[model samples]
Target chain A: MALDRKIAYINLSTGEIRKGDIPLEWRKKFIGGRGLDAYLLYTNNPPGIDAFDPENRVLISAGIVVGALASASARTHIMSKSPLTNFLGSANMGGWFAPEMRWAGFDHLVISGKAEKPVYLWIHNGEIEIRDAKNIWGENIYDTQTILRQELNDNEIQTLCIGPAGENLVRFANVMTGRKNAGGRTGMGAVLGSKNLKAVVCRGTMDIKIKYPEEALKYNEELINQIISSKVSQTMQRWGTMFIYGTTNSTGLVRTRNFQLNQLVGGSDIECENLDKVSIGLDGCFGCQVHCRHRYVIKDGPYAGTYAQGPEYTSQGAFGAEVGCNNMNTILVGNHLVNSYGLDTLETGSMMAWAMELYEKGILTDRDTDGLRLEWGDDEAVLELIKKIATREGIGDILADGPLRAAKKIGKGSETYLVHVKGMSNLHSDERPTPSLALGIATASRGSDHLRSRPAIDLYNLPVQVLEKVYRQPDGYDGPLTSGYTKYEGKPRIVLWQELCYMAVDCTGMCKYHTVFLSPNHPNFPEFAKMIYYNTGLEFTPKEIWDIANRCYTIERLFNIREGLTRKDDWLVDRYFDEPTKRGLPVAYNKKMDRKKFKAMIDEYYSLHKWDNDGVPTPELLKDLDIADLYPEESRQERKGK
Target chain B: MKIKKVMEGARDGEIRCLACFTRFRPKRGVDRAACPSCGVQWRISWPYPKTARLQGPVWETYPKPGEPIAKK
Candidate 1:
């Protein structure tokens, strides 16, 4: 029989370490990885504390099936109070780190307090040591990892660290591993930097036994075949998500020039096919068969000889469509810059695009940007802005604190031009034409993020029968439904169901690409049930798994609610209602999201979750989920002391 | 727009119909897959290895620069 991994409590101020096993009851209720991390976060803090406070914690964990032979089960979920949102800062990344963490014999680490000096954690084969890391503290992300591997004298060591962006407390800094796998949203790296922690280096050879190896192998083979058989997966393997440009840009689903247009005309220069000229090969996370990441090198022109992995579809929007630059080199160089500096590529692009919009409207003068004209298609300026934001120099310093704060600093109704939800900027897609996607980003737990609950398949024009079969079960939605991507009909039901599906997927550490992010027939609850039962001998029926996901999502809601976010926070920018999409085919063109119907949808979604119209989880719902004691004793005491 | 075909795991020869999701291998030198379910014509472009990437749900409706294609 396989044994469970323990959680380590490390206090940096006192340098005290305590270790204990996660309660089996919590595992049954919340599962592991992101779900358990969210639970721990809610119970640890009293709410409304500064994200940079020494008492704020940084929780890192491997999912329940991580390091198992299962494919794509290697997401490392990082959670902290977001300096960006000040509401539930949580992020996940795909890499080799979590599997190594699992082998190091700890499922989770709850890090607290600030260090007196810069340090890093060395965890190996069930033991941990806080070592002085002054040598690598201010290094860029790649060089920091390189230094750690060199210092440890082992190439096999995996490192998760921040760069100068994080060290400078940039609000959207990424905590990254490898060249590209980033815990990319919500500035969790800044949280680590605030504690004077540079990195966590791990090398593990501990045994992780499988309870039912033969059954697991057979089932995993079937699962892998199911994933690889999809046409979307095949496209992913070929062009990465850059293949999405073929549909999104052509159909005007993309955001161009900071939401002024739906698509960029004559921007085919940055197309995925063009990138093949520089392509070396495919790269991917541990044990993933999809191989959906591109490894490319710039071999000519301005960025000659620069090599890196990726410039995902998000990068296309960031540097290409959104900021109005149509050059591939911009993406290549911009991707390299953000990856090295540990900045979130999406947020960097959003800030640049927003600033361009401000400049276009004359709300921002040349003096505000320090005489550097913020113009569309100025690829040089976009690349320069990325560095400035990371290093907190001039205008970069203004955007480094993120859109909401930067808007307040810039004033003159800059907030109205900002595209964000819960103070975090939305992705590069213009969701004005797609109500389902709009609803997902509007109410995402981590603030305008796509990975949380995006139904990427919704715009596939999937047959109504297919949509009904996929989304209308697991608590069967009988509301009005349609196949039209632009319709506001029955979207709340679909969005709610997808929320649970993605929550469970994160809990099990499966990539959304392997699940229902694409394809109507992809794996769901019953598949997760067999996965848990076969691998860990945890017997959960499909319904039980759904209930577990419900519990996990509700806990995240409790955390954000305690942090003072209300139903109004679960809403989109006014642009969705005010401006119609200016490009794409007839189905997408001139379409604006219906405000009244959207509000009604929100009400319906809250009712479905058994919450009041305000989107907070009800007491009855919390009690039903077995997390009735939502806060800890310390939280109550903190409020009393206040 | 031209596409070069190469052998990859999922793109050996077969292409899936965007409308019906019915997958069928083409005859020698056949360049398209007409859906038997919805009677929609899908242009096949084997642009890269590992993907016989379908152009769109309705490829004929693919635009001609800053304008949606005129479609019935």
Candidate 2:
């Protein structure tokens, strides 16, 4: 019944490795993976610790349910203090890495301190070795993996590594696994780079013991059956993230031309059909039946023979709509290039769009751009810019720092063009039209990310009955469409439920797309309980699991509070609230956010979390969640005052 | 420059846009086609499925509504 997962702490400065069981209490409170990792970061890295400091620990945890003989149990949680946002640095990646780590007899790895020289950790059968990565120091992510596997004589080893972008300390650099799956947000790779660590290669032969194997198998079959049967899952399997591009584009919510416009006028033609030309096959993470990741090849184009993993909706929106490039081939190339160089595609695309805006406005020119025209939809320039940013060459150097810092450095009123929340670049979906999405991103802990708490169902325009079925409410609200701007009644409730569910999904190591994030037919609380019970042998009713997820959410809120985040910091870019999204006569046409309505919604959202007027968790609520140890009552009051 | 128009009642099939080089399906009779990316308007003969754009199919073996979900 003991999960028997252990945490390995690696001190790079002293080259020491310490292994111990993760505290059972911590597991009981935070669940596993992201929840525990967040707690560890908050406990180990104190306030004002420099993100690049040796003391800034990067915590990695295989999800509690990962390797539990369930579907898609391949998720890993990577967290550290972000060099980019300087707030909560956390990212979830799906690959074979997490299961490999678990099978290697450890559930978590807390890497700290700077290595005296470039090194990669080799983990096998609960044993750890710090091997010199001197030869592979400057290699790209793909090359590093290949060379490490060759050097270690294990082609089957799973590797989590950084590339030239990480080594050079690009602020938006990410840690990549396989050739494509990246822990792609919040500059975790830069943290790895700052420590002189290159990679963590794992191979193990140990078995992941699960309770009630028969029941688990049955439930997993049922879950997969439900998932693959759903229309949403099937569409996802076919088009990957491309299935929704048409919807986003047609709705005028997709970002275009640095958000100078909302919709791409003729974007449907490019998005609807172009991807079919390149996708060779579909791929998935560990144990997933619904393989949603696209494996693509540019069979015949200027960028021919380019094979890569994905241009997820994020990349497509960034390259296609945000930068005004309708060419899907460029997105494939950009995805491949960024993956090789270990760059966060969303941030890279945002920075590219930012520079293009500056160019179009005459603020930056060919001279500043190193003679490369930084124009919208200039596919050649976008590709070149990706390389330059990764290598930190010319304007790429300025952009390598991400938009917030890059804006300050390249100030000709450049800050005005930045589409960011809390110093991180916004996701491609323009929130000006969707109040729930706007509020979700503004209050999201990791900054401008929808994965935290997006009410995607709100965009479906489903009827009141479907909304009631999905959201568990029947009377108060009509539907998502009817509950648009100025409708605060049901929006706050949906955001709250989604935030908790999302936090729980991440903690349990499930894909958001497979959960209620996308569709009502997907798994929810009851199914989650069955999965957890069969895997960990820990019985939790749906409500109990939700409470634990709430605790995890509060702990993250405290982590941000300790770093001085407040209600004011929760505001979005002025453009969302001010500028009317100008595009076509699409649904989101001329839609501008009403700031007061947004604040009122936030006020209600804060109340839903039992937090105070300024959005700080109340001391009583912290006690109820049993996380009063995180902040004493007076300290909570002090933070609230701030 | 004004785009040249094809006369109505032309043959039905696929036609490639000479301006943008993107292949697209045209309706029967004299069809006005516009390149989605470039907005270059063109007059073309009606084209059928054979001349459809080289885009990925949306539903690639995915279960349709009312179809049983894959058991595997």
Candidate DockQ values, in order, are: 0.16, 0.03
Q: Candidate 1 lDDT, tens digit per residue, A1-642?
A: 454788999999999999998888888988899999888888887568999999898999988888896879988989999999999999888989999998888889999999999999999988999999999978999999999999999999889999999999999998998888989899998999999999998889887788798999888887887777677776787788888876676567888888789877667678786778888998889878888888988775677888788878889888899999989988899998999999999999999999999999999988888888889999888988898999999999999999899999999999999989998888988898888899999999999988888888888777888998888766656776678777877777788788899889888887878788877777898899998878888889888988999998988887887887778899998888999887666667888888899998788878888876667676688778877788444543553464
Model 2 achieves a DockQ score of 0.03
The global Cα lDDT (0 to 1) of model 2 is: 0.80
Q: Cα miss at A235, model 2 (Å)?
A: 1.0
- Isolated chain A: TM-score per model? 0.97, 0.97
Docking class of 2: incorrect
Worst 10 residues of 1 chain A by lDDT: A631-640
Model 1 Cα shift for residue A365 (angstroms): 2.4
Task: Return the interface RMSD of the candidates, in order shown, one decimal each.
Answer: 9.4, 21.2
Model 2: per-residue lDDT, tens digit, A447-475? Answer: 88988999887776556566677666221
lDDT of 1: 0.84
- Spell out the clash pairs found in candidate 2: A273-B55, A276-B56, B13-B46, B13-B47, B13-B48, B14-B51
Please tell me the interface RMSD, in Å, for model 2: 21.2
Error of 2 at A340 (Å): 0.7
